[model samples]
Target: MYSPNFYSFVDRAKSDENGFIEFHNAYVSSKMTNSDLYFVLNRYGLDEEQKDFHIKISPSKTIQPKDKQVGELLEQRLSFEKNIPKAITLNDNIKPNIKVNAIEYIPQEYNHNSFNSPSEHHLIESITLQAHYVLKDSHKKNIQGDEQSLLKESIQRHKHKTKWGYIVFDRDEDIEQTLKQLNKTQPLIYSKRFKELENIKGEIVNIPFKEEWENKQIRFFAYLWRANRDVGWNYEYTIEKLRMELNHLTESAYAIFAKEFIRIPQLREEYQKTIKQISNEILAIVDEEKDKSKKFELAKQYSKEAYLLRNQVLNDIRDKSSEFARALAKSEKPILPSFESLIARKMQQNNFMGKFENLSLEQKTKVYRDIIDSSKNTRKSVNNKMIYYKVFGRTFAIATIAYVSYDIYYSDDRLKTAREHTNIIGFGLLGSSVGMAMAVDTCDINPICYAGFALLGSLVGSSVGNLINNATDTILKKYGYE
Candidate 1:
């Protein structure tokens, strides 16, 4: 129901300067008047006090000569007047003083704010101007005997011209009509206007009148007006077209985000449920296994399944996280860096050994430290090997103790004191310890470290026995007690 600044054509007036008469309204005169004496009036006299002027000029009372005698006399007089054409001057400087009698005409009641109301009826005002002139020839004579010159006699003349009209209505109605008309006339106006706006890059020029509007509607009214003034009414239609296009684009973006971006949370929930189910199944398998070695194998299988599932989830999140972030970025929210790049930078820090060109030196250092800390609690090869050896040694000790106890309790005394018995007991304990130590040190000095430690205890026992026998033989030989 809002209205824009309305414009209407008011009264137009003319003024004579030298011999020429100029017609113009008050607004045009104010803008164009410099050296010329211009009659000022509003094109739409909405601001002025409306007045009615009554000025009527009648034709001269002179009869044309029809007889030969009268025509011959008139020709002689016209010949004489033509010879002295410069002798008389026709002065058109007489300003027509128009006196508007307010009593004769009552002013119409006009509502300046009528467009603000919700009523459908609006007023239309119009004004018209007419001029009457008198022209004369110099060949006529009076009743007494005075010569009637063209400059002295008067005859009626009529010449008139009209200016373009103006129309005013509610801003919305005006815009609607303007759009409809422009569409009917030419559709390219919209595209042309948009193209022009696009061409205006860099710093924006502020339009003062547009800022005066309270809302977008009024602002659009001002915008349309300015555009109309600049590029003509042809471009006013572009505003509506542009607005429609903007709405469509916004809806499309929203639809895409709704269908794709909003599904991520649901997908993540489903994935979490799947992961939990897989983890439970794996734990069940580990729990059901009875054999120790088989239990270890089942745990390994669970670990592999868990790792694969986790990796799949991570990859899914990493890839879709970027797509979701992109969708959000394109929405009403502000722009930011991509999630994929952020994750990539995080992973690079963990796995990269060489210099990462993409990362800053400071970032690389921070990430490297973070990765080390995250993996700090993981077991090393030496710790794993030590654990394995301890468990294996305990099992072997139990077996050996059972065997030795049975032999000592049930076997004969001769068997119990046998050298093989002592060697077997000693070598078993020594060999188990050395074997465990060798397994722990197998990574130290390549092949020699592994071989040396693996045979150290067995070699020591054999060498000692040989030395003892050699000494005994040497002493026997020296005493000749072979």
Candidate 2:
């Protein structure tokens, strides 16, 4: 379970004239303190320099009244966390007691080490911030006041404002109950979550993001949120949707980066490793799953992911090989990387697939089988190519010899005595070479069959060549040369 660095939610933040940061009702990750959060924010390009930040959240203030009784009841029922609106704020100044240090952000797990350039780094940071903030809002409990009428009023107002969307519950029973309470047409969904379901309390949140963000962006963040939390998402239903989105994003990112910037070697290696690790994890799950349909779907998903990863890796290798060649050419003591060396580097990529020793016997067997099959296919391809090359070379050589022999034998009457014999031998050799090439491709690997075909072709060619030579000699003799 490789987890990426989780980001804290800064609902709103601003900078003061004195060059200090103000964080308002922000949610920090459990592992990170305020000082640590500050450092991370700066590192990710979201800091005091940005001047102001805002993320739209739920329970529109205008919809709720200022009734003191309702407010008091809400405060009593909800704790400090539940009472506060989804709004976030930052204080103008850091607390005097809290010491801020310049600490580096080291990821606890490898999520995406491919982001090496400043621009790529910024993109990942932005994605993390967006996903976390949106998720925070989606998980918050809807503020149902003490009175039933107030709750009805709020629901009515919200319902009129936005389209009704599906709700996802953490437990299976919860899903069934919710589905019965609402429309049966609403689908149940599930996905692999990092956290345990028993430890954390789950709430029914309204369609959190669709109303606020663009459809494409909404779906993107939705996938991210579903992936991290321990909830059942209908994998079969969303497999195509999610897989296509991933492909689109991966290809789009690769295209933009390849065109706009030079790749960093370390980043490319990490990216390649990350994809492999993810694919291996998926394969492990597929092996564990007993349900046939789910297993098949998972297999398909894995294949698609692996295919894309392979293509990206091959493209990277090709570009790097060209680059390495160019760089070596420019150097005073230049030496090009060999084909074997390139292949060794490729094989080294599997090192990043994480621990494979822990796999069950069945999984290990399956993996080894796949490797063997792949090797066999590669060998077959190489053998076929070599066969073609050899056949072409032999045919070319034999044809050249036959043509040259005929030209020389006919160029002067001095060799006319042996012209017929030479022609027969040369044509027989050419025919035999062609026959051998044809037999190799069409026949079973039998030496006797090849020899029989070669002999038959040689006999036919000799007869034709001898006839032509004799006819020419007769004509020349009649013309008085003989």
Candidate 3:
């Protein structure tokens, strides 16, 4: 799913004398997973139709494209071949009589998770399905009048015609335009809207069994659509929230660390100013570099320098003032849950030294390194949990709210339900932002503290909204208003 986006084309060429359509400088990229390529190919009929062809994709020495092609195509072929680790051969003899329904064409990955359900990761991006419409028999056949052979032929050919259609349920805004285009060709139908396809007499044949199955499939698809939207919304929300909180935490910690720990009053003002100057220099380097990889490397280098400067400053402060050293040492206690296992090891080694002056320079260095490592580990763990909650937890909550709203507000009064849901969510978000702003200064290096405060504020805001809604309902009932 994280594969780099690149443009590739299948060039058509005639088969050689050996009945082989040999491609030059062409291969499936190793960067592309089998499921990835399968998803792309499945849309164009990988499992639905029969084909009399064999595909052989084997590794070979570097082969050039057509001699005259000088610009982009030549470059692309070279890039493609360079990235390809291995290639696979596909040979199939599909039966003409075999018919695969739209819902049956599931990729290999789905098998591991569920029969037809997509993985959470795939759902986060988009849910693309090759959907089909039920094109019913236009003319009803007289079964009693037809002979046995005629009946068989009519059954095979007259019941329905398979019309292959392409559909993409993209999570992007482009989906609106895509739906519009699809609507021009065939009216987009919702499963909940059409209870029975047979109601459209003359077009739909009365087949109760098939109709029931199709209804189930339709409901499943509708569920997938709802899940897809919920996942996308939660993913974006959590990522934005994480980024904002991280930035706030980093700035706060840096300000506190620089002003309190790094700066030495005894040193010259100019000298003190240069102690934390590398952070600014690293930002400048990042801004100057256009290439992402190079920028990352430069930032990495500066981070190492920053760490050494921190250690040097801590040592200097320790040697000058034991009082300041003790204070700084106390701050290194297990501030985060991630530090427990790490600090436990150190505690056993040093017998949990009470006095900072008693510990050697090596001990101090180890403690500082442990705290840094724990902070990094905490950040990673928190980010993953944040993603999980954003995808599943928030989605569940929203779905529940929506369902409750739907139940409370009858179909005739859906506008009220929509308004109430919007108001509640809006209030919660507004409260969250205000809470974050108020608590950012109090937040320490641990990100969990800030997240907790934000969650508390959101809960309070939602509760207030619910109470207001109940009060309004009571007033309305008291006045005999609908």
- List all candidate RMSDs to the true structure: 46.2, 28.9, 22.3
lDDT of 1 by residue, 428-457 (tens): 334423543555434332333333443454
Better of 1 and 3 by lDDT: 3
Question: In terms of TM-score, how similar is model 3 to the real structure?
Answer: 0.25
For residue 453, model 2's alpha carbon misses the true position, in angstroms, by: 50
Count of steric clashes across candidates, in order: 9, 16, 0
The 0-to-1 C-alpha lDDT of every candidate, in the order given, reads 0.33, 0.36, 0.36
Which pairs of residues clash in candidate 3, taking residues 3 or more apart in a chain or in different chains? none
Candidate 3 per-residue lDDT over residues 146-213, each given as its tens digit: 35454344323322322222222323435445445544544444322323232222112222223122
lDDT tens per residue, model 2, 27-52: 32334222222222232222222222
Deviating ranges (above 4 Å) for candidate 2: 1-272, 317-322, 325-482
Among the numbered candidates, top TM-score falls to: 3
Residue-level lDDT for 256 in candidate 1: 22
Candidate 1: residue 252 Cα off by (Å)? 82
Better-scoring candidate (TM-score), 1 or 2: 2
